[model samples]
Target: MRSYKAKSVTSIQLPPRERRETVLTEAGHNVFNLAADDVFIDLLTDSGTGAMSDDQWAAVVRGDEAYAGSRSFKRFRETVADVMGFDRVVPTHQGRGAENVLFGALLDDGDVVLNNTHFDTTRAHVTNQGAIAADCPAETDLTTDTVGTFAGNFSTDRGWDAVEEHGQDAVSAVVLTITNNSAAGQPVSMANIRETAAFATEIDATFVIDACRFAENAQFIKQRDPEYADTPLSEIAREQLRPADAITMSGKKDALANIGGFTAVRDAALFEQCKQRAILYEGFPTYGGLAGRDLEAMATGLREAVQPPYVAERIEQVATLGDLLRDRDIPIVTPTGGHAVYIDAAALFPDIPADQYPGQRLVCELYREGGVRTVELGSFAFPGTNRPELVRLALPRRTYWHEHLEHIAETAARVRDRRDEYSGLEIVWEPPMEELRHFSAELEPVA
Candidate 1:
């Protein structure tokens, strides 16, 4: 491994373009170089097309006819029915939009929702209801407590008891985030899912699945479990969905070739209620607040999402990055359960205190040092911003290559070697200045 000099005192500033070599030397490649000009591998965001054919775009343009009347809505309904096997489907603009509508419609004041864990936006919506969201597994559950935090661990008697005490009426819904994001992209076992669904049934609580990464989750289940290994990807998807009453999907993550989302209900009446609310918050039921192009792409994207080989290829690429990082001992999340690798910055930068949080420190250091930007998923990955720190590296839909991963491995090893003097700054909330909104504050390191 190569070692580099650390400056005892230096201003934390972007290196001048004229000092471009210094920037590359300090941080490697620009990690956040998705500037529409860089072909440098993109693994920071979840906004890539899965190489959809031009014909699909054409179909979206033709959507005016088949999706015009109630008959068109029926045709769109058939698409959801075919993909998820749910007869009642209500499309939404994107993943969070769908979540907002779903939570707004079902959650009332003083209600509570339980999740394996939650995404940042989801927690915001739950809190927006004047309701609180709680998780059964503690922070240590993902590390050194694998058995206690296994995906199916939701089947534990204690978990069931907690839900029971909350009472079905008090508990608005039980949400299962597929490919459990916070747990190092871990997947939920089928047995656990079925068991939890059964428990939800016993309590008459609605079962909701945040299926943003369903394709990736399904592929993991198929590869790890032998009995399910031979199952067709589509069949496996349907089986996983069978336990839920409603599903919210982000077409951007895996369904649509572009940005869009859908919220589908199993019960016709529930779907109608969701739509009535949609008209107010979103748009009309027919388009579900999405543009006609989005409606068209989502319908076709849902179909392509089920193709097994396509799903497998993406999963394989992610696993490859995991292998690379682990080989370098860069402290990345092992087993690479889902599609992203979470680098444990706390372990990488042990000198940084918890209050300052290494995850936040490393994010600032990486960008200022190398111009490569990644997300701070440790505390930010969760709600409330009070938890173990993490540096999250999301493998965008089809971005990056073997060489890119190699460069990442090299860069991470270098960062790990000189983390002693890096000082991270505190988070400060600010209004988002662009279309891509961030969680909490846009943090920077103290020079």
Candidate 2:
């Protein structure tokens, strides 16, 4: 089973930094505002932070940089088409850029979009375009105690219900985010996908897949379900893509590149409209706000990502971190997600009141104590009292090793030792009616 070694052909060491008395401040109460050197192990997110392979670097060097009809864009477009099963490729700077182009082309005011769980950007973009976003998680009987195998499934009945309630004329799309990020990185069942596709067709609604983490989702399907135990990762992924009329993808995650994304579609009209929008906002359809080399790197990375060992090892590394935290009796999202381990912040900081922002405290403390930087997925991101509170530790691909995670595990145990001591944080400044405010929301430890 082991045919090749993955040792990095490069050396790494700690970058120089000026020791600071504290990582927090009146200005930088949030971890997002922290200086890069202050964070020793940055698990803030997996997006656009992964290490590109040597082969990708080679591709980057050999890329064509023409302003129009670039050969690099052609290569990138062909690769995504072959791997993702889309005939038309419209590149964008990142996932959100793709979303902006696609949503701008497809959705209008008063249109309703359904998602299993909408991540922050997805929801913001929907409402930004004057559309309504509704979440329909798999289980109507959702409980916090037990974690289901496919917690990411979209309810088949709910999709039909949305179409019926709003009238098919008002329903724009049904989106399934692979390894649903908002609900923790859980995989959707193939059965669920097929069922949803049928519902979309019945209502004449577009089935748009948010495939940012498509490869990892496929690996989980093989590992969790016996029916696909022997299927190739890429083919299983293709099956997931089969019923989709359109897709929004982030080259930042599974593509193993620094930055780039694309919107691909089978609907010819939508394809042309998306291209028009991409040009207006992003750039020429060829570059689409990306350097030609970035597109080339994405082309190679997408191909390398599906190879068995690469993805298998990638998910395995994340599980190892989750396992470490579990062995310490720390609570986490069960069946650790493909990309990250989520800490149950509510349980971790029970002493801190919800209004005081306990999750924010945990996030800053990790940075202040162990130089570990992570992001809060609950109140800070959602700004809701009813939403589940979570601290996400998203590992970048090929960027970190076990020793780094071991240090993080030990650091988390240190934080857990004083979890009771954290009084919590309270926002002192927030933007007026901002759709997204976590980036600039100023907070202070509750006095």
Candidate 3:
């Protein structure tokens, strides 16, 4: 049972089947393009979609809106330092903003950034700076039936090979995304983190962690890694960051806030450089691009995020949903993930080739069948990439309950039963940017 009660509620209505079908066609078959009011259960993303706690709301009211050196910024900085063990915290409007600031300052033309697997925006930001974004995922089978505790680990072997392939001097940074988002929200092991950090040191590259879901990742460590079974979430979180030279976070995820993120560093010189970049792109260093209230809420959320009860319940909820789908014989990535349940769209639609976008087809069918909105993270999201075709049902923190999850599972079962009726999707028009075309690309049923 939850330790808290709902203080407020929002009304949601499921649009009729005909209306949903029309909306899908009008939105170019892209869930990202769907209007909010037209959907029943919105699961397109967990970013900035979670509901805040009462404490966060109280902090928001006490926020100091000063232009620079605000009280809220100091509190936020202190909280981040306390929880993440970083002295310098520069806020941003969101996670991508932190990425922009960090990459803008650290990356140059012909540079390379390596990660376990770069989510859509992270890869885009690295490539946007004219740098090569390389993925070094651990050698593990990510098929639906393959189960593991820490499949999100980075392959040090692959990282070393990449460094050699593109001269060591060309490598600028090695990033590890905690609870690897692109790899079905799996958690990275502490042992792997230490090994990857050592590898980064050997290569003389900055060890950066994309820590959007840091707390959840830490909780996973406590549960899965026997060494940390007795450790507190806060200490685990600190240990997770201790190896990183710097971190870029999207506060939207673990921070439990609506908006705000930060790029934190241990080196004062590098911190100054990131601050200067923040000034140029975001607002002043203190406020970055967010309101003071956002900083206050983020601070409170950071504290709340690491508490044992909150993290355990949050992770368990996701696992519950995964179990629901699995009981129905749905092909889902196992042992489920921290924030979302990844459905193997390729397995679901074996006849639909990668070029036809099976993942996107599933996304469309789920919406049309049951008013549940989801996003594709396969060929459509990462064009030409030889990765699993997945549809992520990202659950927002504290926003859903058992019934909501059941509805989602029932919806998936309904669609799966009539899977033969669904076909593949073909992109009719896409943007010039090849990396992020899934966000706005227009598509249609492949006839």
TM-score to native of every candidate shown: 0.84, 0.94, 0.99
Instruction: Quote the lDDT for 277 in model 2.
Output: 99
> Which candidate wins on lDDT?
3
Residue 271's lDDT within candidate 1 is: 79
Ranking by TM-score: 3, 2, 1
- For model 3, the stretches where C-alpha displacement exceeds 4 angstroms are none
Query: Residue by residue across 1-447, what tens digits does model 3's lDDT show?
Result: 987789989999899999999989999999889989998999999999999999999999999999999999999999999999999989999999999999998999999999999999999999999999999999988879766889999999899899889999999999999989999999999999999999999999999999999999999999989999998889999999899999999999999999999999988988999999999999999999999999999999999999999999999999999999999988999988999999999999998989999999999999998899999999889976798899999999999889999999999999899988877889899999999999999999989
- How many clashes in each structure? 3, 0, 0
Model 3's lDDT to the true fold? 0.94
Among the numbered candidates, top TM-score falls to 3
For residue 48, give model 3's deviation from the true position in Å. 0.7
Error of 1 at 353 (Å): 1.5
Better model by TM-score, 1 or 3?
3
Candidate 2 per-residue C-alpha lDDT over 259-327 given as tens digits, one digit per residue, 9 for 90 to 100: 999999998999999999999999999999999999999999899888889889888888899889888
lDDT of 1 by residue, 66-181 (tens): 33344445556787788787887777777888888788878889887887776677777888778877765433334312323235234336556666677657877888888777
Model 1 poorest 10 in a row by lDDT: 1-10
